[model samples]
Target: MNNNSSIDQSYTHLEIKIPLDPSANERLRSAVLSRLHELYGDPLPDAISDRVNAELDIFYNYFYSSLFLTYQKLVNCINGSGLPYYLFSSNGASLICYALGMTLVNPLPAHYRCASCRHTEFSNSADSSDCGLILPEKHCPLCGALMVSDGNDLPIEFFLGLRYDKTPYLALAVPHAMSDDAVSLLERSFSVTRKDPRDYKFPMEEGFIFAYLDIVPTDSDPESEMLWRSSSSAPSASSASLAPYEMTNARVFEYLSRPESFACYLPYRDDVQMIKSLLAADAVSVNNISDLSKICGLINSVNWFGFILPSLKSGAVDYRSTITCREDIFRTLVAHGLDSETSYRVMEMTRKGRAASILADNALRQQLLSHDISEDYLTSLVNIRYLPTRAHALELAMTVYRNASENVQG
Candidate 1:
């Protein structure tokens, strides 16, 4: 256990234990292999074997033993305590997670149970009518549970790949308030990194997962924004003047470099990560156009972010209001020679989803039209950016409610 006092006292005792150097990855490797053998039965299928090895390789190579260990400990903690949680993040797409009982979502070749007969398992594709996910799926003649499409249809590559890294969001769904005894146990079991002492609230960009929990109190000092922690981890001496949650140019660029898995509003805190990641990188591409593939495909995870602009009146950015505004730094991106396709899609999401007339300057639109950008091509970009950040919140809440109910039953 880390003997250092937690930055936040709310998480004083909890510590996560993991090996120092897991280069060998043998212990985890053996554990996962044994679990897979038990789940899929003996000599695993080729497709399954390939997928397992691929994910494990990444996990091992990155030295993400703590991540897996965290999941294992978290699940054990919740299940042993009889709490209910539904895993729904991209990390939930891993078969290893499901086998470990950390998730109920499955990522594998889609399979369906026959509704009428109940016993028939089909390897073949099921049309929309036969799909259980869409409706009263083909009613299993023999049973109902078998006819449903695997509860998840997401690509595993979306969650983790050889080229990627992720910060796991194990949002706690505490159903209700904990008894003092339960609270003690919970505190002794895990730790939360503190946001900053100035505000005591988490950076809203990170979605304030514990905003409702009152695990930390709000810092009421008015000059708190100008304050700085003198720790080595603090941004920089020059940035010491910025508010705890406010962004500096360096901070913005650094965060943009590695897009977070959850959309955080931390230049604000507590806003959904999905919402934050959407727009920043798409616009950043305007300047770094030559690295378009790396910027768009690899570096930035989502294209749904806007620049964290300064507040005009007070000259202080309010983290909460900054995120809710639809205005992005698109115009600025256009000023830097942003091309049509990326700009048009990003701009479409703002100001009522229209591309040209509303968000884009007419001069930029004319430049695009001069290049013969088509209306069809402009509209072809799909809006599939719906991720369930709220569901994570609710899952933790449900767990709390369940725990409360169990206590009542007991």
Candidate 2:
């Protein structure tokens, strides 16, 4: 950061107020200096100090204003609501963010130890996504309180470089709440814009950051009608001429671009965004998903999870049901990779109960959690059940089937 603030006659007025708080820059510096000293000893090596200072200056200058405050508010809201939020940006590579609690990923060296000698070593090796606590267990003779990883492999320079500020970071937040209640906290924050279905975008304001609020959908939401109406009203391009994912893509773009989140916008959860991600993915061909038109018709027209059951020969789904599953149609959904519990839920929805009960069954719900199914995915199913909007869910199902096919092919 240039210390010389020569007159900048061309500056815009700052509109948003940054809440009065301790300097994040100072906090980052203090933490970095202490960590460096621990690693390099009292008289820190000059080269390391220079590198650290340069990175911190860039970090402090850029974020200490708009980005920092915007994240602070959103993070605080997520924390207050007892929901999980994550930064999706490579800011994970910065020590300041890890120290500042902006990211859980540790950008530091991997910790290791020698089991025989009881000594400790910190170096990059087999690593986990969780950078801080992950360690390869070994011990050697050296007995220090800790070991530090050599960051040279992927240094701070890789993140800060000559121009880091040009990038805008994105974050995803998922919260658990009733169908009508999920967006209550987000509504409390400063909502800057509301999208319109006709594809409208307002100019971004100064003090605010853009947020794609995936608020829960409720029956009262007038915006919901827009999607159903638009999809039906648009001349469904002849199936032969329709681009893969085009309909789903247009619908999602319309949802986000429209000024809907102002008590009038956003989807029920991040699963919708996940659908967006799946459609945007480059590594996969959705050919199989296209082929399963019969299953898609069954799923979009009849049941959200049910159509895939018969094709899925797993014990969870009844084989007897496969006969009734309509194979003469050329293809059907084969539920794959899902555990017995999810398959069971599909079976239940197909045969006995409502999909909303999938989470209501505490035992099975816990099992799903135990299996580490994403909150976004599970919640999407629950909402789809309540929504009874098979067509919208079908868009997601197509993406899911496509992405799964790619993963298997890979």
For each candidate, the alpha-carbon lDDT, in order, equals: 0.36, 0.36
Candidate 1 local distance difference test against the native: 0.36
The residue-by-residue lDDT of candidate 1 on 1-410, one tens digit each, is 00112212342122233334443367667777787675554566676677778777777665555457566766676556643222324444566665665654445555454334434333455442211232234555554443554423333443552235434434332212322333454557765333333333323222112221222211212221111111111323332222211221232333334434212111112222322343342323211111211222211112222223223123354332222211122332344466544453454343233443442566655555555654443432122121222112222222212222221211
Per-residue accuracy of model 2 over 255-280 as CA lDDT, tens digit each:
33222221121222223332233234
TM-score result, candidate 1 = 0.43
Error of 2 at 10 (Å): 37
True-structure lDDT of candidate 2: 0.36
TM-score of each: 0.43, 0.35
Candidate 1 ranges beyond 4 A from true positions: 1-24, 84-88, 112-122, 126-151, 179-183, 190-386, 389-410
